[model samples]
Target chain A: VGPGDDAAVLSTGADEQLVVTTDVLIEGTHFPSGSRSDLIGYRAIAVNLSDIAAMGAEPRFLTVALTLDQIDDEWVKGFAKGIAFCASKYGVKIVGGNIARGALSLAVTAIGVVPTGQCLLRSTARIDDDIYVTGTIGAASAAVKDGVKVPPLELNELWSRRVDDMSCRYFMPLPRVQMGVALRGLASAAIDISDGLMADLGHLTRSSGVGAEIELDRVPVWKSMDAEIAIEASDDYELLFTAPAKEAERIAEMAVRIGTDITCIGKVTAGESVAVNGEVGRIDSPKGYRHF
Target chain B: VGPGDDAAVLSTGADEQLVVTTDVLIEGTHFPSGSRSDLIGYRAIAVNLSDIAAMGAEPRFLTVALTLDQIDDEWVKGFAKGIAFCASKYGVKIVGGNIARGALSLAVTAIGVVPTGQCLLRSTARIDDDIYVTGTIGAASAAVKDGVKVPPLELNELWSRRVDDMSCRYFMPLPRVQMGVALRGLASAAIDISDGLMADLGHLTRSSGVGAEIELDRVPVWKSMDAEIAIEASDDYELLFTAPAKEAERIAEMAVRIGTDITCIGKVTAGESVAVNGEVGRIDSPKGYRHF
Candidate 1:
């Protein structure tokens, strides 16, 4: 049974060994208990997996940290079900974890891998690399903002639906798994859009030691939201990536192969600071969810 | 330089694979902020790592979950120093982690391993196993109690030193790495004593589908605290384990090899329930640390 062993041995047919990351979601900060137990559990692991995905790594295993106040079999069962569902969907395994007591929170550490030296990163972006993002953005923030303000009863079903962006992306944000895998050899640098595009791209530029000229006209926003609203709201969880200008067409082809949307937003420059249109803007020094 | 890559690259030789475990430590329950930051970091990783050591594993890489109200570089530095000291002490690598905003807490997910199928567990005890433990217990709890009470005697370093049990184990509870490795083939069932010995033994017996006879006379207590005070106090982080009755001498020799103290406290039987004498006594369940 391999019981009492130092480590749980997990074998992967792939060459590159493992990808690891951890994120702590607190009780009052990440979300209110308003989220279903199932989604909460799913998102707990999903967020960490997304970090792995952003590296273009295939998630194979996760170790979760859960702090609890009181133990309830049923509640634990629900949480486990959510975790199991995510694992099954991603072809990952729940190898091991610690269950301790405290204020309710989740700390998930996900590990995965790609070729030994072939993972994507923001540091690899060249000065002229084109910046692109995959799928819709800012829908989650809109969901949060609109979900709280219930619409009037006089509205029609369509109008009622319009009251909130129940795009299912906020409660259960999709990790760009296929897109990330496809970009393994295509994109030079990439990150998930946990914050706004401007903010995350700022991270990309800072890490890569380059600036970017992001034409607002070329930047993509959730078609449903007002352009200004989408620009400021974050929590998109989409893929914000940088690829060599020469490979932009190939990167687009990759997104097509993965059945994901791709939008060209900006191009890398030789200096520091992200410029919106032609002007050096605050986009270069992007600010995200500040929880001080 | 696999910066921002989809997956992080880690290299391990054949002799030493990766040992992995994740644990969540919360505030108010695990520690108060006034609790020494260095010790909090030390114990957060130490308690989680005790599981790995109990399995006879070497600690390698760690992914930390840092939740904070404000980003105090000093606190971060202290916490990092604590982790770095232990990681360096155990030859562990700190590769990557995420910093999130929330209540001050830590969830350290550590990875280390020994050979395949060599990890220890609580389900391996046999019918006639002689139970053994490494080191004095209840020191951590005593330390915790001492940490809260600020002694009123100024310029009394001797008295403060004499009274601070928390100063000993509370901040620096030892993980029984040597004893765990020594029990590879000698001990049958094993687990680190997170809960008190009696309570944790209850888990051991339950896991093995057996009962145990733990003589109150044989249970190990810290020199600084009386047996009565230590019984209910936990945070010992010692290895409470069982081996074949025939291997008692070998067990002692192995304990010597590990440079840790050992005591034969009890034996395993073919029934259910854990007890101090011969009956299932009230161990008080340690305020229920498992919550869902």
Candidate 2:
């Protein structure tokens, strides 16, 4: 039974566990004026997919709840196409959802599956475990800061290309699902960097009942970004995970196989505070986006 | 194992099938101005629960994605309390969700479980099956229509009581989970009556590749509601189902056991059109809420 049915049924293997997460993107807030509807739909699903990946689960299904203030045929068509494109790339099926009238916004609840006892948890990071972050950070945040502005039509080709690249980064974030699934058995604890790299690391340390020491010099930040800004900029949907020191080589090998850079920039320690560069400086959100 | 993790994990029994559905409630649309924040939270989850019940599934878990334009401490507290209360009532847990800054809206994805291969599907109604509806329709629709107007403080006691009752019905819907689960093996096809009685019946007939003849005189309507109005009013949140004529007695018994009324108002036939009161009348929406 499909759309006409009141609910969708999924048959799960006895030993498999279902992983669920949800995220929302709003028009005026998340996607400012002149934003593409396609990117809005894509980002809405990507953020939730990042959460599922953080748990080292295989993406399986999704339900999208969309609300629109006004019905524009073109906009709706573009949004649906974007959703279908992103869902196909992630191999997730659109199961069930509701559409309603309101401010333009989308909420996606993504379901994933993992073998029992194989889910990576944020509360399992052990002390002395090396903390690693995958891919470069701060590019998406920088893009969002600079991409929304409309440039002059007569702008130089080089500048136009630069703007286009930045906008693309801002619009489509690559959820590191492959690397997350690969770290299933190796990672002690993991969290996605949706709330800035350092803030999410803080969340992991708090959940694990420990602290972390981050080396600013070793952090992989986007070019021209300040280390401090990179640590506070949200929208880097990369994985930050903790693993034992002995698995560093295995982690590197997995990253190589996945074709993404993974850097060990910190270590878990005793206590319940996060220290950046040997100082007791906590990750602060000076200009970062806060969900609530 | 729960909130602190990236996603929630649900362990299903070997033979259990998972049923999923999602719904959204927007402030300006679903609840108009002057609606209570607590009820907003309650209805957000209740509507999704109704979807699960429509499929004869036991409600299990939910993920709520909330976006708010502005932060109000009291509103947020009441909303959370309402969610907690509703979750407790349905024995469903708040598993995973996201909170963001945007238009005030809530999207909840509910997960339920049913026995494998036994889900009451919408496309399974056989020709000549008697069609039935659970509970009175039009109360919720009427309440939403009338309750949005602010009542004068000097109103009489009797009128105040009437308004209060109507508004309560609009705010709090009782999902017929018990009746749905009980009708699992008895009902050939089932659908929730959220998009009005006639519209939903049309959906059922289309999916089943059959037609229905509804006797308007036999349809149950709320006090003071016209038969036509009741059939076209949205937000009834009741169940419309089909079963063989021989099972009418059993359906009535189940309804009595669940403390709700079940009315046999129609019958399925081999055709492709819905006829009301022996007339080929299709339900048309004049001012009904449309999502798209």
Candidate 3:
């Protein structure tokens, strides 16, 4: 479904619950100047899909509201193609959307579905639950750092390869949809790492009426990045969840089956705030990119 | 049902098909400079609900992606209250959404549900069907005209009342959801008049692979406005639909029962373009506010 219709009709099979989410990406704020149109489109949909994935559901439909500063045919074509590719990649359909004139921005809304009563929620995490996160963090932050202009520095093959890897991660975030779906019936609570683990974990703890203590040593970070900064870096788009401590081994096995690394990094506690290594303190304002 | 979770999960009762649509309202594009945030927020949701109404469905959930130039607590509170009021008015749940920093914009995605296989489509109008429009046109355009700076003009009670009515229509568009739902088994095809009569009718005719012949004198316009200009003025969020010629009386009765004015101004023809009277040609670029 493209523009021109009033609305799109989708068949939601009987006995299913619909999951809905939306995210915004602005050209001058979210991405740097001179960003590729294709990547911009892909990232818009990817972030919304990550939200759906964090719900432990399968994404089904996407509606994009795109505002372009000017009508560039090539840019529009590349953007459409990129959205179509991402939709196909994750089995989601581009259902309906609106195109308008304004500052360059993309607001994507994704719809997903799961079996009735099976959706994961941040309010369900319980005290004593083990916290886990998928994949490494800080790569996107590292990439954004490199994107800024700087004087040339000495580079070895190892450093050059690392930069290339992080840049790729920055442009193409992989949503752990499969891992999220598998975590259903296992994870007590789940959230996606978009506003950094520290900030998002605070949200989870507040919602669940519990707290968490992270073992910084057990957390994974991008090469040469500090564990604290990695945990505070935004745009990771990885699943962060909690499960009963006894199910930690089973969750690890599920991750292996899905071909993603899962690390047990913390434990939920009885409180309403998140702590680092049993020390109670506020998670400071994000040093990583903040949407607001 | 809020921003803390990954996504909002909703129950879709058995055998219902989901209808979804999205619309964006950008500062300086959709509204005038220094517009009230409350009205902006209400209009954003109102437009999307109008799309759902055109599909002959009942709105159930909404996800909004709001990007602001800067964080203003009063503006945010007012915007939230406006959205809440409209959601309560229409029974739409505030499912999930994102708030980010950037150009002031609100992208609203609404999801509705209709009986299985009964949702209306633009491509279903039959040749020889009678085309009808709900409500009077040109009021919104007139209101926008009056909003701009103007020299002092005499304001008699009659003219003052008329101006107030038109401005009310401009600020608060009543989406004809109930009327659309009632027309489900009656109207052949339907579309909401967002881009005005001619452009939207062109969309309907093209989708149905048919043509339309409109009688200029039969169209209802705001006081003293030309029929052509009224038909081309945007933001008159009325419903334009086609029904069998034989059922015109019944449809008119239905409109009466629903407390709205319904006027038959045209008929579907066995061709592929919309004509004013017997003159067949393009509608040309809109004289109304064009999005792009």
Local accuracy of candidate 3 as per-residue lDDT tens digits, B93-208: 88877788998988888999999878778889999999999888888877788883222232222223433466655646778889889889899999999888887888888888
Model 2 misplacement above 4 A: A148-165, A278-292, B148-164, B278-292
Error of 2 at B275 (Å): 1.6
Candidate order by decreasing TM-score:
3, 2, 1
Docking class of 2: medium
Q: Assess each prediction's global lDDT (C-alpha) against the native.
A: 0.70, 0.80, 0.80
Superior candidate under DockQ, 1 versus 3: 3
lDDT, candidate 1, B84-154, per-residue tens: 76666667667775677887788887776666666677777888799888888777776676665534332
Chain A TM-score across all models, in listed order: 0.85, 0.89, 0.88
For model 3, the local distance difference test gives: 0.80
Best by DockQ: 3
Give the DockQ of candidate 1.
0.44
TM-score of each: 0.86, 0.89, 0.90
True contacts kept of 1: 0.58
